[model samples]
Target chain A: MTLFQQILTIAICAIGTMTTRFLPFIVFFRGEETPKYIQYLGKALPGAIFGMLIVYCLKNVSVLTYSYGLPELIGIAVTAVLHIWKRKTLLSIAAGTAVYMLLIQFVF
Target chain B: MKIKALKAAFPHTIPILTAFAFLGMAYGLYTRVSGLGFVYPLMMSTAIFGGSLEFVTVTMLLSPFAPVQALLMALLIQARHMFYGIAMLDRYRGMGLKKYYLIFAMCDETFSINCTADIPEDVDRGWFYFFVSLLNQSYWVISAVTGNLLGGFIDLNIQGIDFVMTAMFVVIFLNQWFKEKRHLSSWIGLAVSVLCLIVFGPDSFLIPAMVCIIALLTFLRKPIEGGEDKV
Candidate 1:
């Protein structure tokens, strides 16, 4: 691809991405009374969205494969436990990631 | 004032600093190994900040150019951002000029942190969010440049460090799980996504999972809104 085409392709991507990010704001601007359904969804969607995100992150973890996803399983467990026990977001993430790194790099 | 907000937001962003540093380096190395100059990765990361799409763009660049296909694929891959935009409508409202950048830079991690983290009352809300977005972008860009410049010369055993992203999401999920009284929505999200993943496979499960999630959540609106226990 020429430099022009490459730039165009990347620009297309950037534009596409900006569309998604800005679409909701464009559709539901604060100047007007937002619909009740959207408002409800706005309130309710985060819980599920967060859940879906978690699943998204783990989408590739195949339990039937080699190592049987043990690393992910233990990693998630450690992360969850540390978060719940300490209630410190950064610390829990750091600890869990550290454990997973050690497991995959050495123990696994 | 901006400095104070930056100070407040920086600590929360430390995990991202680590994650993006390595991830960005990987991205840079990928571009470098592909025989592209540092300019490509730098510009891609700056303009198209979404991690997955940036990775995808690498292959697209190598392939025969198809502008329309590239655009459509980008839209499809990034459709999830629409959800984030909707979810953030209220909080991001009244943010003024920072609002535009906030929306533009709303990657998965940024959205998760800004959405959930309780910024102190004293900190400037807009600035706090601005710092998060800005700092995250800097980490990614800097690391990408480093990797491109170093070009496979650096090696470290950071094999599973990518799990940091997963761990971060899991931690956020747990935070939301405990905060809400009803686990119905959370469960629906997990079950539906897993179901979609199994049925559709990982490659194309996300859109279907998102659609299923929205459909189910809309269907359960009466009970979910009324209260989960009432269902």
Candidate 2:
């Protein structure tokens, strides 16, 4: 692609992305009462979204492949356990990532 | 007020700092190796700001110049942001012009932290969200540029460090789980996502998972709102 074409492609992507991000807000514009259904969604969707995000992060992990996602599973276990035990967000994330790094770098 | 909010928001973004540094650099390196100049990754990272789509965009840029296809692919890949927009509708309201940037910068990480972070009452909510979004994007943009410049010259033994993103999401999911009284939504989200992933494969699973999630949630709205399931 030419330089102009390349820039256009990136611009197209930017527009496409901003469209999805901004559409809902434009439809539900402020100061006007949000729809009952949308309001319900605003209250209910975050929990589900968080769950989906976890799965999204691990979407590429193939259990049938070599090592079998063990590193990821163990990492999550450490994270959950540490978070539940201490409730320190940073600590849990750091320790879990550290364990995963060690596992893949050495154990796996 | 802005300074206070920035301080409060900084800690929440620390994990993103580490995760984005690696991921963004990897993206930059990929772009550089793709025969593109550093400007491509730098501009794409700054303008697009969505990680997955930006990575895909590199390939799209390498291919034929299909603007329509690029645009559609971008919209489809980013459809999930609409969910974040819906969830944030109320929270982002009345913030004046800042709301525009918040929505524009609402990548998965930014949305996750902004939606979930417990901002102190004394701090300004708008500024808190602003700084989190700004800081996260800055990490991504700067790292992308650095990676493009370094271009395979540096090799670190941090192979699995990308797991920080997964770890962060897991912790966030667990936090949400502990906070909510009912687990149905969380269960639906997890179960449906896994099922769709298996059925459709990772590449195309998200939209299906999202569709199923919304449909299931709408179907169960009555029971969910009625507070019938206390478990």
Candidate 3:
């Protein structure tokens, strides 16, 4: 793409991102009562987002029942246990990723 | 104050850096593989800073796809930020002129983390928010540049790399889940989305599922438990 094209795409993306991210603030955030609907969204959105997120992360892994499933499953299990146990973000990622890389490189 | 703000942002932006750096490195390396050089990642990072959007950009660029289609898809994928913003109304309101940075930095994790954090009484909210925003972007830019440069030297079998963000989301969810009450609507969302993905097939289900999730969550607000049960 041309320089102009990159700029235009970036502009559209920035605007779209900003609108979705910032517009809600200018509308509902200024007042007394925070909308109950918004409240409900906050409660529920993360779960749905993360649920999709898990699927998204695991999507690339081929699932012929058990062929390439070990590493991904182990990674998830490690991450879950570490997170629930340690509650340390960096450690969870590092340990999980490290274990995963090691598993793929050496184990499976 | 500005300098302090900048400094303050560095520490809070650690996760952003850790997460984006590997991805950036991968992107840069991919640029190398795609018959490009350091200039590509640098330029893309500087001009187009969106993380997943950058991946989409690579796909579109690598193929014969039109820029218009790539651009639309980028926006649609990032549409979830609207939810992030809405989640941040209370915090964003208190921010003064630094609202610009806050808005820019309100990417997925920063918003989620900040929403959970109890803003201290005496701390400068603007600086706190600005610092995280600034640091996160810098981390991404730096990582992408590094990855591009390192691409030549490394032969990384980096498939499934993009899933780090997804994994991070799962980590964050699990982190929050045990602390917080069950969000029934989101479970409903998961069920509905998987069904949609199966029915519509992978290509067509995302936007529809997201729409269904958002609509269902919005409506389920009143009956569900209050959003804040944990930190």
Best by TM-score: 3
Residue range A27-46, candidate 3, lDDT tens digits: 76655465665555555666
Model 2: number of clashes?
0
Tell me, by DockQ, which candidate is best. Answer: 1
Compute DockQ for each candidate against the true complex.
0.49, 0.47, 0.40
For residues A53-83, could you state the per-residue lDDT of candidate 2 as single tens digits?
6887788898999989999999999999999
Local distance difference test, candidate 2 = 0.83
Q: Which tens-of-lDDT digit does each residue in B77-155 have in candidate 3?
A: 5666766776677677767778867776677767755776554565666777777776777777788778777766667
Judging by TM-score, tell me the better candidate of 2 and 3. 3
Tens-place lDDT per residue, model 2, B61-164, is: 87778887677668756776877887898899888999888998999899999999988999999999999999999999999989878875666565665576
Q: What TM-scores does chain A show, candidate by candidate in order?
A: 0.75, 0.72, 0.76
Which residue segments of model 1 deviate by more than 4 Å?
A: A1-13, A28-30, B1-41, B48-136, B147-151, B228-231
lDDT of each: 0.83, 0.83, 0.65
What shift in Å separates residue B70 of candidate 1 from its native position after superposition? Answer: 9.6
Which ten-residue region of model 1 chain B has the weakest summed lDDT? Answer: B152-161
lDDT, model 3, position B33: 61
- Positional deviation of B187 in candidate 3, in angstroms? 2.5
How well is each residue in A1-108 modelled by candidate 1, as lDDT tens digits?
Answer: 998999999999999999989988999786456588776776577778767767777777889978898999999999999998998877787788889889888887
Clash count in backbone of candidate 3: 4
Stretches of model 3 off by over 4 angstroms after superposition = A1-12, A28-34, A65-68, A102-108, B4-98, B108-132, B155-163, B218-223, B226-231
lDDT of model 1 at position B14? 97
